[model samples]
Target: MFIPFQPLRTSSLSKKAPTSVGRVVAITGGSGFIGGHLLDALIADDTVSRIYVMDIAPTTRWCEKVTFVYTNLARDVQFEPQQKIDVVYHLAAVSREPGFEWNEYFDINYEGTRRLLKWASKLDIKNIVFTSTGMVFKAGPFHRAPSEVPSADTAYGISKALAEEALSGWQQSKRGRHVAVVRPGAVFGRGCGGNFVNLHRALRLGTFAYIGGPDTVKSCIYVKDLVALMRGAAELKGWHVLHGTYPQAPTIGEICNAFCKVFGWTRVIPTVPLNLALRAAAPLQMLNELGFSNPVHKRRVEKLHYSTDIDGSGLLELNLAPTHSLVEAIQDWRDECAPADPH
Candidate 1:
């Protein structure tokens, strides 16, 4: 659990300064939540000359001067960066929530990643920052502290665990790659519309319900903080893993209470028996898998209990210094749903 989380060297302000204008970079899933935020951050840097946005979905708004490439990385498609790529942020994958078939998850999360990494190496790409999730550490001997144990709760965790292992192994050989692995916990931000977003909206509308008591802890990172970690990772070497999240580690009760505090509403949620929830969730989960919709069945009741403990010593070393507050991520979400400016 203890690792030297410091940067290999001191970073000067200049180094962190924008790369020369017109610097070209590649980002998969650029149209998605985290990806979109990173894209915006990159564009704000005066050093960035150009950004190559690639994803399965089209961007709502793309910079006129940037390059936009569309490709489904899940398939057997070959992808090559058209311009001189400065840094490659690998963020695209499946399993937006869960319930996909074993093969489908493998094809996208595992095989698709393998394809992208191999292509990058072949292209002599050196700077690669991968957006991995913290679930890789699930299935742990639960009840241990995040500071004490590493465990995850799903096959999604296993896929990422294996993927990181493979990537780190490559770095060991001094192969044609240097990687920075960013493992973020639950992420909420604008345009994410992820699993948590629905929950937030549901709770705000007074329709959301939970079986767990208020004390079920959850760890989450704001999308903006995740973007900062990705930028810092571009300057990393070998296999460096860091979690982009808050240290407070709020619980399920705390999350609901926070919503209540912000929205001025409260309702006692009825608890469904765990066994009943599990039995009923399987078929619903299967349906979600078939339709490619995120599954929030009975199994999720257990996920809320996952240890929110995450170490960020590695993040500190990179000087990424996440400045965004975790509450802000949710607050913005609430604002989006609350009301709009009259302008």
Candidate 2:
């Protein structure tokens, strides 16, 4: 019997993770940042016998158990599994924004998902975990709230949302197949040059300055926590979908201040009003719309003024806990990716 997705609510322990012991797993895009971390975790698990990595290229991080299979979802890539894959983590997608063409985005992101689903149908892979972005939710006053509706305001987000729809359709068409779509918000950590990477670099070099009041709330999840979420998703039965973010999202100002304290930077970052910043970046925004690459594009500037507050209640309802703290995770990132100057 197939259970349709419902808004997550408190359920009994019957909804707990099914045993993954002695399961053979496959991860698409396992060469990427989050996938690599997940691969590491899977390798460490004694229960998992073999790990299959399906990507365009091989992962730089080498392990004895991990077998890298060269597969491109864009093409007619053949997926002949040596062993039946009990769980497959679909993490591959074109996440780049602004620079990519519409066709390219849809082809890689949306179509890639379709190809995977087709392969899954052939292999009868019941458990699948797909990584979608929090950007699928439209930006508005609900930034500080849980995003209930699945809508995309950007090309990248639209592509992911469509991929999610494809997954939903696949589940509906079959029985005993479980799918989990995890919408992670601003995932950051070692080896991840996400939104926080630029912020960290600028702050380290004393060039990080906020144009608008840095009070915009942004939800974030550490990569390790994301891995945990993926593990939970793979084990959970039925079709589940939820946002993966910090329970209480911190504001931009709060994030900056925390970093300052951590790095021992005594200087206060400057901030201007939203209107002033928008006025200054208007010309740049116009140029960007005309196909020019503008660093201060209107969309980029708008993100700073708005809130992306995420609700983690869904995760709680599933009884999955994110162990890492934001500051601690950021500190780890700095130590590995960007070390502080001991001046």
Per-prediction TM-score to the true structure, in the order listed = 0.79, 0.86
Clashes of each: 12, 1
- Count residue pairs with overlapping backbones in model 2: 1
What TM-score does candidate 2 reach?
0.86
Q: Give per-residue CA lDDT, model 1, range 1-343, as digits (tens).
A: 0112122223321133243447678888887778777877886777777676678876554553355666687765465544568788888877554556666666777777777767766776777788777777752223322243334456676667666766766566665467887778788766666557667667756776564445655667777777877887888766677776665566677777766666577777655555666776788778876885654665575665345556654555567746765555566666654573100
Residue 200 of candidate 1: its Cα lDDT? 68
Q: Which stretches of candidate 1 lie over 4 Å from their true place?
A: 1-21, 75-82, 139-153, 267-273, 279-296, 305-308, 313-318, 336-343
lDDT for each candidate structure: 0.65, 0.78
